[model samples]
Target: MRIKDAGDMTSKAQETTAAVSRQRHRGQPYVGQPMERLEDAAILTGRGRYGDDLGVKPGTLHAAIVRSPHAHAELGRIDATAALDAPGVHAVLTGADLVAWSRPFVVAVKAPMEQWALAMDRVRYVGEPVAVVVAESRALAEDALDLVRVTYRVLPPVVSIESALDEDAAILHPGVGANVVSDRRFRYGEPEAAFAAAPHRVTLTAHYPRNTCTPIECGVVIAEFLPGDEGYDVTSNFMGPFSLHAVMAMALKVPANRLRHKAPRDSGGSFGVKQAVFPYAVLMCLASRKAGAPVKWVEDRLEHLSAATSATARLSTLEAAVNAEGRILALSYDQIEDCGGYLRAPEPATFYRMHGCLTGAYDIPNLLVRNRVVMTNKTPTGLVRGFGGPQVYFALERLVQRIATQLGLDPLDVYRRNFVAADAFPYRAAAGALLDSGNYQLALTRALEDGGYDELKRRRDAARAEGRLYGIGFAAIVEPSVSNMGYITTAMPAEARKKAGPKNGAIASATVSVDLLGGVVVTIASTPAGQGHMTVCAQVVADVLGVNPADVVVNVEFDTHKDAWSVAAGNYSSRFAGAVAGTVHLAALRVRDKLARIAASQFGCTPAEVEFADGRIARHGAPEFALPFARVASNAPHWSPQQLPAGEEPGLRETVFWSPPNLEAPDENDRINTSAAYGFAFDMCGVEIDRATGRVRIDRYVT
Candidate 1:
C-alpha cells in the first residue's frame, strides 16, 4: 500500500493527539516512572541462565573448530585420521560433511556468492572454519583440533577496498565475476542544476573504520538433531533479526517449522554483534547429526574477535551545493562500503540504513547518492552500534563544517541556517523519508544554551593564545528508530524489488494474559541484552490494568515454536520503545477493554462509564459501587460465566501485532520511510589537545 499524503498524515496526527489527551485524563501513573530492572537481581545473584548454562543434557559433546590461517587459499585435502582416533574424539567433520548435509545460505542481494558455515573449495578470509572436532570435553576437542591436517594453495588476497577495486584484483566469488557485489545509483532531486547554480561548493572524503563490540559472554550454541522428522532443537545466545531463522532452516535443508530456535534467558550483550551467530548455530546442528549426539560450542575471545562480524568499513565522499549564507541547497554522496569476505545478509545495509536521513537535520531539497558494496578478504561485516549513523553523519557533518569555513561563518550559524524549520514537520526529505515530527531549531537552541556555548568559545580562545590546541564542535542529527523491515530492500533496484513483491512495515508482537490467580502476565518477542525490557513491560501492563507494577510478571524468553512472533521481532534498531513496547501496550489495552466489558455488566453501566483504578473496577460516577479487580477477573473464568457480558469471551488473554501506518515499501522513485519514528539530538562538545603527547581530553560535552 502507498503511504498517505501530507493532508491525511496531518489528520491522523490530530487523532493521535486527541487519543493521547484522553489517555492523560485517564491517568497513567506507572509508565514514565523509573524503576530498577527486574533482571538485574537474578543476574547479579548468578541465578540467570545464559547460553552455556542451558546445554546441561547428558551426552552433550563439545566442539572445537579448526580454522585456516591463510586469508585466501584453494582447499586441497583434509585428512582427519589422527584427530578421529584421538582420545575422547567422537567425530570429525570437514567441508565434505557440510556439502553432504547442508545447503549454502541465501544471500540478500542478487549475487551468486555461496556462503557455507565451513569452507568448501576455497577459503576467503583468515579464521574461516575448515573443520570441526567433537569430543567428550572441550579440552579434548581442542586437543583433537590440532591433529586435523588440511592442505591449501595460497592465492593473492584482496584485503583493502582500494586493492579490491583494482582492475586485476583476484575474484573472491567467481560466480559473481567481480568483487563488487551490489552497486546502485539514485537521484532524488535536480542535483546537477542545483550544483551549477550554487554560489559555493565544498567537498570532503572521510573513512569509517570497521569495528565490533565485545560482549562479555561470547557466542555459544547447543544443537541437537532430533531423530527422524522431529527436526532440530538449537539454543544459542544469538539475539536476532529472527528473519534469519528461515535462512538457517534452509541451510540445514529442513522446513522452517522443523527448526526450533530459542535464546537463553540472559545474553551478556549483543549490541547487534550476536546476529551473526546464526551460521555457527547451523554448523553445530550438522556436527550434532554427524556425532550422533548433542553438540555444544562456546567461542573464545580470540575466535570472537577474528571470526565474528564487525560493522562495515565505509569510504564516503560528500559534496554540498551552498548559497552565500551557508544554507545548503543540495548534496551528493559517493560511498563505497567494504563487506568483508562475503555480502552477508542484512548488509550493504550500512549504505542504505541512513539513506532516508542522508541530509541529517538540514533542509536540503536535492540529493544524489551513489552506493557500492565491495567484498574483500576480511571478516564479513554485519550490525554494530549506531548501524550506519556514524559513517553517514561523519561525512555529512564534516562537510557542513567545511562549508562554514568556506563561507567565513560560525559552524553553529551554518547549522542554524540549514536547520529544518520547527513547523515544517511532518517533513518529507528529498530522498523519501517522511520525518514524523521534530523541532530541530528548538532542540539546537536548547543544546547551545545548556552547553554554555559562549563560555566554551572563550575557553578555546584563551587556550589557543597559550600555544595549546582547544576547540569546540557542534552537530545536529536525526536518530531513526523502529526500522521498517522493508528498508533493506532498497539495496535492490526498484525493478528487482517489484519482481520480489512489496515488503514493508516493522511489525512487533506481544501477549497479555491474566493468570488463574488473577496475576498479570506479559510476554514479548524482544530479546533484551542489557536494556530494561522486563521493567518497561511491567510498567505498561500495570498502568493499563490499574495494578501495582510489582504485581506484574514479564517473560522475555523467546521460543520459535511457542511465541507469537513475526519475522520483525527481536532486539535491534532501538525498536523496544516504538515497536515492541507499543505492541505490549496494545495487547494490554485489549485485555483492559475486555475487563471493562465484564465490569460494566456487573455495575449495570455502559463499558465506557466504568472506571479502572487502584486494583478495583467501579461505575464512573458512583465510587460506592465497585468490585475488587481480582474478584471480577477470577470470577469470569472460574466461578461465574453467566455474569459475563453477552458475546464476551470467558478468558482474559490478548495478543497484538502492531506496525506503524506510515511504513510503506520503496515507491516508484524509491522513496520510503526507513523508520517508524524520528527523534532529534543536538550535541556540542569542547576538547583540549595535548601538543606534545598528542592526547585529546574532553573538557565539556552535552547532547
Candidate 2:
C-alpha cells in the first residue's frame, strides 16, 4: 500500500527507474540500475549494531551531564558534593576540571572564539554542559544529575539574528568584540551598471525559520582510555568524515595518532545531524580518562533537541533587476545568518555551501552577495540536507514570482526566460560556480507535464474566483554535489588567505581487493546513514568484475585507524553519487585491469584483446577460449609469483583516490567552483490559506 501511494505521485521517478531497468537488462548492469538494499534484513530483523548497542567491560561507567537552564549566564559555582554522595555514583567532573586536562577544540574556519567539551567560565546557551556525573548505570547517572547544584548569574540573551546584529547587543564572544563573527561581500560582473540599465526591479525579504535534523536515535558515545602506551578508543553511531579525529585529539591535548575513532556499521539517521556528535565524543573521552574505565553517554530526547545543533536561521533581502520581458539582468542578496553560541567546525557551511548556486538556475550575468554570520544564544548550526541551496533559492524564487505578479506576467514564462540554456554546458555562473551539466528547461518541462500544470492552474484560478484563497508557486533549484573545501577559505579575507596560501577541492578514496576464492571486497571511508551505500558499492564492483552482486562484499565500517581515508572523505554534500562512486569505480577498474592482463598472458594474447563476458575473461569471437575468474584470480596471490605478467604485482588489490579537476582556489575575487556536478530540481507548491486562522494547507507539492 505504501509503495502504491508513493508510485501514484512519483510518475517521473518511475519512468527514470524503468529506463534504468531497460539498460540493465541489456547487460549493462549496475550504475543506473536500482538494486535492492543489502542492509534491510539485518536492520529490520534487529541484527544491526548501533553505538548504544556496543557493550563494554563490566566496570564501565555511565555519564550524565548537568546543563545550564539560562540561555546566557556567568558561571558562579557548582556544588557536586550531593551528587558525589548519590548511590552508585563514582565521580563528578566540573568544567574547570576538564579545562585543566584538555585544550580548546580546533577550529576549521578561523573565528575569534573558544569551544571546549564543557562551558568553562560561562554558559552561552541553554543546555550548555557545566558538570558531568559518572555512575555504575545509566539510571544512576540520570538520578545523580538532579543532585548537582549549579548557580548562575543570568545575562541578556540575544535570541534572533536581528537582535544579535544590533548595535547595543552584548557580545557573545568577548574576543570577537561583536556578535558578528564573519562578514564578507562577493560580486561578479557590473551589478550596479546592469541594475541601472534594467527597466524593472523587484525586492523581497524573507525570514527562514530555524529547523533541525532530528534523528530517531540521539547522540551516543563510548570511550575507553587504555593504560600505558595504549591510547584512547572511542566508538559512536557517528556518520563522519573521520577528519574530526584530529580536532578531538587537539582538544584532548594528545597526539592525533593516540585517538582511535570507530563508528558503528549503522546509525538510525543523520541527514547531517550526527556531524555534531564529535564534541560529545571528546567529552565522553574525557569522562572515561578521569574515571579510569570505559564511559558511555547517551543524549536524551530533550537534551538532543535543546542542545544539539540546528540549521542556521536566515534573514535575507533579495533584489532582482529584470528587462521588460521579465528576463533577470542583475541579482543581489544581503543575508544575515544566526549561528548559535560558538561557531562550530562547520557551522557556517550552511551559509557558504551554495556560493556557486546563489543565482539558482538563472543566467543572470551580474550578481552580488553579502553574508553576515552572527552569534546568538541558540544551538550552534551545522550540516543539513540541501545545505544552503534551499535558502538562496527560496528568496530568489519568491522574488521571481513577485516580479511576475507585479508586472501581470506568467510566473512560468518568467522562469523559462531566465533559465540558463541547454547548450551552455559547463556554464560558469556569475558567482564562479562551474555548472558541469544540466538541462534546466527539460527538467522544468518534465515537471510541468508530470504535475499537470495546466489543469492545476485552472483549478487554482477557479477557486480564487469563488472567493477562496489558492495559489501555486514555482522554483528552479540547482542541487550541487561534492563540495570543494576551498569554498570555506572564502570566509577569511583575501589578505588573510594570501598569508595562508591556496585551498580547494574534495577527495574520495576506496580500496578494492579480490580474495583467493575470487570474491571481491571493497572498503571506503564513507559512513552510511541508511543510504544503502553498501548495496550500491557492491553493485558497481560486480558490474565491473563480471560477477554476481552477492559475490561482492562491501565493508561499510568507518574506522580512522584502518580504512582508506582522507580529510575530504565523507557522505556529506551529496558526494556518494559523484565523487565516491567514481572513486570506487576507479579502484575496481584497476583490479579488473590486472585480472584481464593475467588472463591475456594465459591466453597468449595482448591485454587489449581480452574482454569481459558472462563472468569470464575471454577473447573476441572465442566463447570456449575463456578462463574462469576464479582460475585467473588464484594465479596471482596463491599461485607462483613467476607466473605473473612483467611489472605486475602478485596481488589483486588496488587503492585509488579521485578528486574533481574543476575545483580551483578563489582568485583576487572570492569566487570558485564550489561543487562538481550541478543537477536541477523544479518544485511547484499549491497552497490554500484560511484567512480567519492564518493556517496554510498544502494542496499539492511536486518536485
lDDT of 1 by residue, 191-226 (tens): 999999999889999988888899898999999999
Q: How do the predictions measure up, each by TM-score?
A: 0.95, 0.94
Off by over 4 Å in 1: 1-28
Error of 1 at 560 (Å): 0.7
- Candidate 2 clash total? 0
Off by over 4 Å in 2: 1-26, 693-695
Write the residue-wise lDDT of candidate 2 on 1-703 in tens digits.
4444433434544344334333444266766566556665466546677777877888999999999998999889899899899999998878877766798886656767898889987889999888889999999999999999888998999999889988999788988899988888988999999999999889999998888888888888999888996678998877665566777888888797888888888888888888889999889888888888899999899999899888888999999998989999999999999889888876577887888778888999999889899999988778866778767777878898999997889998998999999998779998889988888898889989998888889989999998888988888888888888888777877888889998787889999998877778999888888888887888888788776565577887778788888878777888897888789999989988888788788888877778764467787667777887777787665576788878888778899988899988877788778888888889988888987888999988999
Please tell me which predicted candidate would have the highest TM-score against the true structure: 1
lDDT of 1 at 374: 92
Distance from true position, residue 695, model 2, in Å? 4.3
Error of 2 at 253 (Å): 2.0
lDDT values for all models: 0.87, 0.83
